[model samples]
Target: MSATTTSPRISPVNPALATPTDLSSEGVAAIADQLRDLLADVFALYVKTKNFHWHMSGPHFRDSHLLLDEHSDQIFAMTDELAERARKIGGTTLRSIGDIARHQRLRDNDKEFVEPRTMLAELASDNQELTRSLRAAHAVCDEHQDVATTSLIENWIDETERRTWFLSEIAGPR
Candidate 1:
């Protein structure tokens, strides 16, 4: 005798998880795609920031460490807001770290050691790139008339700019 095995059947679309929205399906798709990519970049930066924080060492180690810790916290906080925003608009989000890797546009650092100034400089550049991405996402929201997402992106752009400014100041002319 042989036991029969079957895989659970799933629907092509899960209406239950899809929140109600007034936006057109096309708008939802566009917004969701942008948000997913944005979230991916945010997550990548967060990890890199934390990595630098953990590995920070220098004359100003304490200050640099604290700064990166703060930056990482701020970056991590956005993950939930972004994911939820996508869901609120009748869309899905990333499922795993691999999903994030697949969507992220930011580069990761895997060096055994990174100079404190170098870390600061790299993070600053990444934050600048993030600001650009935020603007792009905001443009999508504008096209879709997504005021809620636009508002969120505006605040995020400010925060990203602040992060970039701090990193640059700390890194200084080196």
Candidate 2:
């Protein structure tokens, strides 16, 4: 005569995780979705930057490596900010590397070796693309009246532009 035990009821998905905001659900979804994708691109760029930094081998190895390290740090910093911004506005964010890969528009670099100048040029182009994407996201924020996110995106755009400028200068007109 064994006593039968009843299973505890599982609670449904909590709505509290979706933070409240003045923006409409559509606005929140649009902004958050854009941000998630932007964050994915940022992650891709960050990884690639580090890859270049680690693999750097040239006469200017020291300078190129240092520059990529700094750039990768900047790019990595944006990931948390982007994720938090999305969460703050009542939307979900990337949960895994797979999610990032799915949303990322930036291509990955897996080559065994890339020339120093080539790396710089590729990174500059990627940063340019990232700048454009950031501007597009800013437009979405403007449409949604999300000034906070807009401000953050503005700073990120500036940073991306600066990175591009440095890389372009170093790579010399390419």
Candidate 3:
């Protein structure tokens, strides 16, 4: 007697070659939305941090400015990574400041010469916003079962959370 074997069906990924049948369409979309939201938050925070870095004034001016600039650069890099991931998953990353302003939970004061303490407060709040956005993105990634993206986001979230805590401490228990 001959044994019969069956092959598992393969799904196409290219939207051009055949009908796109993403097994995790809902998941991918959710992940995409979350990433987009995170991107906006990070971009806003990056700009805010840079602004404060340039305008911060106090006895700690030099130290605070340098740190803020470093943090802003890191945040910008994180934003780029998230945007690249979105594009990798066939989703467009939102780049406009208007889009960021619309989606951001944080506000900017845009001061010409803000006090160092005030800059610290603003940076703290912005970092907290970044934390919130990252956590939401992690949840969305979990929903989509995107482990790679999820892992990358976890590192970012942890770093942002730590930075927020440090800033909050400097802001004196607020």
Clashing pairs in 3: none
Residues 44-117, candidate 2, lDDT per residue (tens digit)? 99999999999999899999999999999999999999999988988878889998898899899999989989
Count: clashes, candidate 2: 0
- CA error at residue 121 for candidate 3, angstroms: 1.7
Tell me how many clashing residue pairs each candidate has. 0, 0, 0
lDDT of 1 by residue, 33-145 (tens): 88888899999999999999999998999999999999999999999999999899887888899999988999999999999999999999999999999998898888889
Best by lDDT: 1
TM-score of model 2 (CA atoms): 0.91
Residues 4-121 of candidate 3 have per-residue lDDT tens digits of 1111122223464222325265555566667776787787788888888777777778878788888888888898798778767655557577877766666777556777777787
- The candidates, ranked best first by TM-score, are 1, 2, 3
- Tell me, by TM-score, which candidate is best: 1
Worst 10 contiguous positions by lDDT, candidate 1:
1-10
CA RMSD, predictions in order = 8.9, 10.8, 10.2
Identify the runs in model 2 with alpha carbons over 4 angstroms from their true place. 1-14
- TM-score of model 3 (CA atoms): 0.81
The lDDT per prediction is: 0.88, 0.87, 0.71
